[model samples]
Target chain A: MIDVKSLSKHYGTHHAVDGISFSIGEGEIVGFLGPNGAGKTTTLRVLTCFHPATAGSATVAGYDVFTQSEQVRAQIGYLPESVPMYPEMRVREYLHFRGKLRGMTREQRETSLRGVVERCWLGDVVDRPIGQLSKGFRQRVGLADALLHNPPVLILDEPTVGLDPSQIRETRRLIGELAQQHTVLLSSHILPEVEATCQRIIIINRGRIVASGTPEELRERVAGTSGLIVELKAAWTEIEPALRGLSGVTEVRGTPDGSWTRVALRAAGDQREAVAALAAGRGWPLRELRREIATLEDFFVKIVAGAHEAQTVPVE
Target chain B: MRNTTAIMNRELLSLFCSPVAYIVIAGFLLVTGVLAVFTGSFKPGAPATLRMVFEFTPYALAFIVPAIAMRTISEEYRSGTIEALMTAPVSDAQLVLGKFLASLVFYVIMIATTLVYLMLMMVYGAPDLGASLAAYIGLILVGTMFVALGVLASSLTKNQIVAWMIAAVPLLVFVWFSGWISRAAEGWWREVFRIVNISLHLDQFNRGLIDTEGVVFFLCTAAFFLFLAVKVVESRRWR
Candidate 1:
């Protein structure tokens, strides 16, 4: 539903979104992940026609964002990063204004407003002024405004940022439900939220896409080897050699903790059986033994760190 | 056009919802009323017309109208609502015109409230109805020009106080200091400033003379600033 081709947004000499190309299929929930100042918001703004690209092009719902901004705007529902709202207006009144801006008729707006108010769990605060509502409620109001017209494409920037745990969960569930009918491109600096909510993730750093894939795919690609953490009531010198001698064990490192020692084993394949046998043979007390799979957080850190290092390295 | 009305309606709703509109209106009425009744001695056998009200309105509106118009676009920029509003299915022209109309409506209502002064004159003495109407028309035209200029100023800055000063400085020069500057010059330089003098153009309307030149001057002034306001807003997409 959205296609960005070599999109570059520059503020004078600095490119906020630099030659980043990505697309979202219809009805797909794509999480846009990046640390702060990673051009996530800039990309969304370019797609929404809020800001024109300095170079390259973007199209939404088959309409060019630059040339046919109104059509592109009509098809996309955008909830800006800041959740911009009129604090003096009531929740319903604010949504009503947004609905009208979306060109919804009176009856159409009323019906859509009812649906979003319920979907966003804004029923209780619908009558209250936005300034009086809590941050979570205000965030929900921003979401409700975006969903008021039922646009086919939803562009939400940091949708669940200020929400409490329960509200975050509910927002995740709502986005998951929304993916059934609408294509969603949401950005969040929080990785776990994206892992829990998005079907696919596109990670950007320094105005470029550093990685893109499913969470599991990213984990596998960035994670080189499977490993195990073993704690035994033995010295580091005693445990390291025994694990190193085991089959399929590539490397072994140990840390001494007085009477107990912790051994971390990196292996080419499943070496848990061999380590367990070695522990049994030694007649040493085994406190804890657990296999470790590289998590999405680890992969994200490695990828982002690599990108940051690449930029900082001076060229000849 | 529908989107324009929607924006205008929302802007009007926003204006009335806040205390700023009422406060500005009350302040405007007080200034104009006091200037008319006390300073000008506008009473029975003393012209007994809205001349004093019209005479001081341009000066009053120069300060007060900018105060009202200062927040129209600057507040959107400050609050980040400009992103939300710009992302909507509306043209830049529509947004500018919508805001212009909202400010115009507010000015009309504020200026309209002074009609009671006219009613009081009708009760106490015979006032020149034609000149009174002409003066009001002039005030509306001048008010339109100021609001447009103020909206343009607001579009340029995210700070409301800065927007107020940006617009107020030019207006202050035109209302209070233009003729003084013109008198300091000689020959065509004096004539040039005289032609651009806001008060000179407004006085024609106050004397019940509907000069096409004066009407066109104010209309062009309003149209030019409004066009500049639209350009200023649309320029954001580039930056």
Candidate 2:
């Protein structure tokens, strides 16, 4: 439903987004993952037609964002990062106003208002003024406003930023449900939220897309080998030599408590059985021995850190 | 057009839902009433009428209309609501025009409250009915032009105080320099100054003269500022 080609945004000398290209299918839930100042918001703003790209083109639902912005706007719903709202307005009234602004008739707006209020779980406070609500409720109200027009695509920037853990989980569930009907492009700096909610992930760093794939694919691509951490009730002098003597053991580091040592086993496949047998042979009590598989967080940190280091490296 | 109406309705409703509309109306009436009573002794033998109310409205509007319009677009920009509004399926022209019309309506309501001065003139003295009506019409035309200028000023910055200052500066120039130019210059320069002088043009209407030139001046002023407001909003999209 969205196609961005050579999309770039420059504020004078600073390039906020640089030549990034990506596309998302009709009902797919795609997560845009990046750290702060990673150009996620800039990319989303370009796609939403809030700001024009400096040197690229983007289309949404077959409408060019630069030339046919009205059509593009009609086809997509955007919830900006800050979720700007008129605090004096009631929840229902604000949604109704937003629906009308999106070209819905009064009858249509009324019907959609009911649906959004229920979907965003804003029934209890729909009549209260927005200024009085807590931050979590305000975020829900922003989501409700975005959903009121029932556009085919939804672009939400940090939809779960300030919510408590329960609210975050609830928002993730709601986004998952939304994906069944609407194409979603969810942008966030939080790794686990995107992993739990999105089917596909696009990692951006320093105004570029460093990686894009399914969560499992990214884990496999960025994570070269599986590591087994064997914590033993022995001194580093004894445990380090024993683990390094094994075939798959690559490195070992002592835990802070000094009561145990953690060993990293580097292998293409599972080496749990090999490590377990070695522990059994040694007669050393193994407090914990678990394989350390890389998660989305690990992949994100590695990619972002690598990008930062690459940018800081001096050339000859 | 549909978007404009939707935005206009929302803006008008918001104005009423808050205390802004009421406070503006009350403030305009109270100021006009007190000025008329205090200045009545210096009337220079002019007939008792709404002429006094019309004569002082431009001065009151130089300050009051900016307060009403200072936040029209500036607050939206500062609070990031402009992102939501501009990203909707509406053109910049529609958004600017909708906001301009909404502020114009509020200006009219504020001007409308000064009708009490007219009622008082009718009850207390034989005021010139024709001059009074002409002056009321002039007041509204001048107020609409000022309000449009305020909207354009508000569109130029995200700071409401800055917008208020920008709106007030030109009105201040018109107030302070128009008389100076009329006295210092002769013939053509004085004519040009009078033509561009908003308050000077307003004097013709307050004197019961329905000059078409004065009417056109007020309308052209409003249109020019509105066009500038639309341009300002469009520039933001590119930046």
Candidate 3:
């Protein structure tokens, strides 16, 4: 129920969110994945009508974000990244205040408050002041506030950022449960948080949509390749040239060994068989043969490992 | 209308919760007492009217109203609460008016405490009740405009101290300096300053004169500042 096209937000010389566009369909829980300072929060803010886009357009529930801000805001419930709240207000009072601000009637507010408080597990601390609450409780309070209006759309930014491990799991579970009733668009830098809760992941880097796909699709396309490691008595001279010659072998590196050579090769699919044949044909004594690293974190390390100036960030 | 009331109620709650509200109230009463009662106005031989209290109120409100209103918008901006607040269904006009009215209400409550001075007048002398009522109305109008001006200043910055200064400097100029500068100026310049001087407007009411023209001026001035506040708030998107 949210659509954006060619959106750009610039602050003088720095482009916070350069031209980028994405859409979240109804009942879909999409994860906006990006490292810090990525344009995720900026994009969410534009959708929530907190600010106007420098160029292009955005609509929430078919209401224009810029021109029809109040209507757009009414259709969506947003939890800001900082979880801005009145510190002095009790959790119950604060939620009621938010409900009023959303134009919910007293009856609607009362009914919604009960559901959200229980859903967010804000039962006992409802009467306690927010300032006195811990960070985890504060995050829950922010979540509860977002859910209190019961809008059809929920836009949450880093919903589990400061939570404890258990709280993180609970928030993920809550978002999963919320998907049944509300279309959610949550942004986070953590990979598993996105993978654990989102049906689709949109990876943004340097204000651009570098990748967007389902977790499995992303794993296959972005992290489909595996790394090859071979330990042998061969010299770096023969191993480098021969391994680089193999098909789908994109990168090769060697680490110092005691009168032995250990080489690491990054290649598409698997190159273990090829390397074994090469060692046999070259008449070099082979010690070990295996796929060095080929897990999700290989994707994490490949994309984020900085191992060889990876193609994670495209050269603009 | 409902959104406006919601914001106004929230503003009142926040105002009452902070120490600044009580400080402003106590400060105002202290200043008003020194200026009108303790120094001269309600003495043995002097006139036992609330004329002194009404005359000096605008001066006291010059500082008091800003202290009450500096947090109305600046705190939200500083604490980053403006995101949620502005993104709610509330309009910019509603937020501005709600805050302006909240400050006005707090000022009224503070001024109500001065009614004890009126009761004191009831003890020894025959106070002019009609004039006293007119003065109260006049003060409320002046307070309305002052609160609007303060809200406008608060909207311009996220610093409460800066907001207070921004509202106070012009307020002092409008209330105190205008009358003095008008006395020094010649020709229409003098008349211009005199007509624009807020004290001159309050003077008409101190004598129990409810000038419809002054009433319109106060209301229009208030509306003008509130309009500026709304514009200033809307300008955030450009940043």
Ranking by DockQ: 1, 3, 2
Writing each residue's lDDT as its tens digit, candidate 3 over B122-176 gives: 8988898999989989999998999999999999999999999999999999898
Pairs clashing within candidate 3: A301-A305
Q: Against the native chain B, what TM-score does each candidate's chain B reach?
A: 0.96, 0.91, 0.95
The regions of model 1 sitting more than 4 angstroms off are: A12-14, A231-250, A259-261, A277-288, A303-316, B39-41
lDDT of 1: 0.87
User: Model 1: per-residue lDDT, tens digit, B86-150?
Assistant: 99898999998999899999999999999988888788888889988898898888898999999
DockQ computed for model 1 against the true two-chain complex using alpha carbons:
0.84
Residue pairs in candidate 1 whose N, alpha carbon or C atoms collide under 3 angstroms? none
Question: Reference contacts recovered by each candidate, as fractions?
Answer: 0.90, 0.83, 0.80
Each candidate's lDDT (Cα)? 0.87, 0.85, 0.87
Candidate 1, residues A1-316, lDDT tens digits: the string is 9998999988888878899998889999999998888899999999999888989988899999999999999998899999889888888888888888888899998899889989999989999999998889989999988888889999999999899999899999999999998999999998998999998999888898877888777776645578899988877777777787887788888888889888888887677777778888999888888889878787666656777663432121
Residue B151 in model 2: lDDT: 91
Model 2 Cα lDDT, one tens digit per residue, B60-160: 88888888888788988999999999888989999888888889888888877777767766766778888877887888888778889899999999999
The TM-score, computed over Cα atoms with residue i paired to residue i, of candidate 2 is 0.91
Candidate 1 C-alpha error for residue A185, in Å: 0.9
Candidate number achieving the greatest DockQ relative to the actual structure = 1
> Local error of candidate 2 at A108, Å?
0.9
